[model samples]
Target chain A: MKKYLMKGNEAIAEAAIQAGCRFYFGYPITPSTEIIEYMARKMQQVGGTFLQAESEIAAIYMVFGASGSGKRVMTASSSTGISLKQEGLSFLAANELPAVIVNIMRTGPGLGGLGATQADYFQATKGGGHGDYRLIVLAPNSVQEMTDLIMDGFDLADIYRNPVMILADGILGQMMEPVIFKEPEKIEIDKSWATTGANGRKRNIITSYNLHNEAGEEKALYLEQKYKGIKEQEQRWEEYHMEDAEYVFVAYGTSARIVKGAVDQLRKEGNKVGLIRPITLWPFPEKAFIPLLNRIKGYMVVEMSAGQMVEDVKLNVNGAAPVAFYSRQGGITPQPEEIIEKFNNSYHKGGEQ
Target chain B: MGETIFSKTKGLTNTPFHYCPGCTHGIIHRILAEVLEELAILQDTIGVAPVGCAGFIEKYINVDFQGGAHGRAPAVATGIKRALPDKVVFTYQGDGDMASIGTAEAIHAAARGEKFTTIFVNNGIYGMTGGQMAPTSLIGQKTSTSPYGRDSSQSGYPLDFPLLISQIPGAAYVASVSVDTPQNVIKAKKAIKKAFEIQMKGIGFTMVSVLSTCPTNWGMSPIQSIKWLQENMKNYYKLGELKTPEMLNQ
Candidate 1:
């Protein structure tokens, strides 16, 4: 492994190139522009394509075209740009094309701010686009994880014939950390379904339109079963100091990094606290909490949003342990002290029976 | 036994068209299929169909086809062509899909000189959506949306996309032809063939705007629609090669 100090956005670009991604289309937006700029400088050197599209809408559709041609393709954008891509994302899902999208999320219901926020948690996990579909969502906490998760994202997309999203916040996009660049791993992929000019086979048709009722229903059933398989096979999470913990902090992405610090400080103060960091946001590792539900008295979900991932935590807890939320909105992250203060006030004050 | 003079082109599938009786989409599809067959690149060609009456072209054209969102065919074609430069790539779009909602995409695709062929079909109104006034609808034309006969004071005049695209230096081949008569149909086929040939040579963007008719949308018979198109569309849109690489050389 070759180690280097790299920013999160640059690490992601390098990882994508190592993962065999050769086509990149994007529009420039703050906190996420570094990835595109890096691709612009490096893609041509690697014999790949990097296009600054007219808009986010065109960029995503361009990805759709490139992915249909059976190439490893990717695109990156920020919150408002991601919203513009919802239509193209829906088309990619409906056509069952494999691609990767990265969202370096900013604070927003609209264009809220350029700072970091996890407000897109609900949007990422709950299928931001129209239609009954799900993108395999991966949340990365550090620069290294950002690199590793992108490599994993491409594989998962091809394995399931679905789109995968790497959901990171502005903080992760801007932060720098030491990372070890792994050599490109050799992976075998079947291109039997791709539209490579038919090549003496039946002509390939990549379309989302199912005019008849039966055909549309069948596509829906196939996608539902695929989601179920993903849920069963791909739930990933990390546990810290969980053995004798009475209170657990449930968080993901940058919030999980903050929660780790809070858990360590609370443990030094003789509080039985631990952290549950979810790496895959869509799968929502419910089984991790199932066995420890009785021993854990309460779970606190720390997020940069008002309260989004808390819903998933509550759904997973299901009354086995009370779930509370501590959050800061509009790009303001909750400090470790703020999380600890909220936890002590809530759990020790008879907040959870 | 007599020699068979006419037959269905091998480039087309066995699927019958679902277009209206007087609509010219079927004619356009047949000519495009014949061109691909004549070029002997049907097996190595990928076509993009846009969101309009021609959206179901994949069913008729026997080649790899990708369905594009409304007004995004140029972007999609750019992707496919850029990814597989060795293969022939093209997009078939209607006026509303290209000239109206997708104006920016088409222009920028030309500006980038994306090496692909675009077969732009221009009728007066939006046929698939029940004959709404399109961006290319004539000044006095009346449709469902323009019941008062398209007033230039409110709705803008028709947009001549071929003329607009001809101005771009990146555009290698640009032509506007009609399908109203046998002579004009021959001219349309010639232009379509030239556009594909330019793409085969890896030249810059090429486009051919084919003037067609929609009898159902115009509330006229098939014969009436042809005559109406020739008389009105010809006056506004000049039928000839608007630009070519040869012009650039001279």
Candidate 2:
């Protein structure tokens, strides 16, 4: 492993290249644009493909075409751009095409500010595109995981033959941190089932087609089974100081970074505070929090949206303990001190415990 | 008179097409397939079929095919070509995909001069969706939605894609052709082949606008639709190669 200081967006782009991504297509949107720019410059040197698409709609379709041909492809966009990509994303999901999409989230009900926001939690974790489909979402809290999960993202995407998302925020995209690029893993290109030319073989068909009612039902059943397998096989989380801790600080991506800082500060004041940061958002590590229910007094969910993820926390905790929400939206990121204050207040009030 | 009825260029395919009767899409598809076969690049080519009538083009064309959203075929083709430059890429698009929702993608693809080809079929009306006035619909042309002839004063004027595309510096070739007659069909094939040749040489964007017949939309018989295209649409979208790298070679 080689240690280098890098921004989260740059790290994700670099790791993608190292992990054998051959195409990057995206539109210019704040917080996510840097990732596109980085790939645009780097992909050429690596003999990969890079394009600044006409719009997010075009960008995602470009990804579909490249991925359809069985090459590793990717795209990066923010909330508004991602919204444009929903049409193509639905197509990608339906076709079971392997692709990587990075959403450096910004605040938005519509065209909100360019600052970090987790308001896209529903859009990213649930089915944002169309049809009954899902994207495997990875939520990284630090520069390390940002670099690490992109490699994992590509692998998971290929394994499932599905679109995988790195759901980050502006803070992660913009903030500079120490990152280590692990040794490049060599991967073999598999074209046995790929839609390369129809040379001397039966033409390989890549489509999301349900010609009849029975076929549609079967396709839906197959997809549900795949999702269930992913839930069992791919749940990842980081439990920090949860043992004998007073409150569980539940967060992911950039919010988790601030929560970590808050937990450190609160510990200096002799308060027992810890964190449970989710690395994979879609296959949420519910089992990690389930064990903590007996020991933890309460759960405080911190994100950049208005209680988008708090619902997940409540469901996981199962009313064993109360869950409170602390949010910062419309592009403003909650500071470490503000989160600490809320935690201290919650602990003192003892309503959640 | 002893010449082969089908062009020597088309790839081998066993199944019949699912297109509507008297549709010109089959002719256009055959022209593209023939061009690919003649260039000896059918084995190295990928085609993106857009939404609307051509959504099932994969079944007809023997080459590798994929589908994109209504107007985003060019964007998807751009991605595929850029990803694998050695592979020839093209998009088969209709007026709806090229002019309406996908206008942003289409113009940008040409402007950027992406090294690929676009086969644009301008049939004056959106045929698959009953009859809607397309961006390319002629002024005073009537459609189901436009009960009265299309009034540019109310609805926007018909967009001239070939003229607009010719203005982009990145485009290496731009042309407008029609499939109204056998002679015109031959000219359209040449235009299509030239576009493919430009891509193989790594030249930037090339587009061919094919003026086609829409019998159902025009409220006419198949032959009358052909006659209408020959008499009316040809004046609006004149045929011929506007620009080509071959000119530079000459």
What fraction of correct interface contacts does each candidate retain? 0.78, 0.63
TM-score of structure candidate 1:
0.98
| Global lDDT of model 1 | 0.91
**Highest DockQ model number:** 1
Residue B227 lDDT in candidate 1: 91
The C-alpha lDDT values of all candidates are 0.91, 0.84
Model 1 agreement with the true structure over A148-228: per-residue lDDT tens digits:
999999999888888999999989999999998776667788877777797779988998876799988998999999899
Give the per-residue lDDT of model 2 (tens digit) for B1-250: 6977754445647678776677899899888888888888878888888777777777788788778778888888887787668888888888887878788888898888888899999998988788888888988999987889899889988888877887777788988998878888899999998898888888789999998877877889899888888878888876688777755445
Candidate 1 wrongly placed segments (more than 4 Å): A351-353
Q: Give TM-scores for every candidate, taking all chains together and pairing residue i with residue i.
A: 0.98, 0.92
Residue A218's lDDT in candidate 1:
93
- As a whole number from 0 to 100, the lDDT of residue A267 in candidate 2 is 84
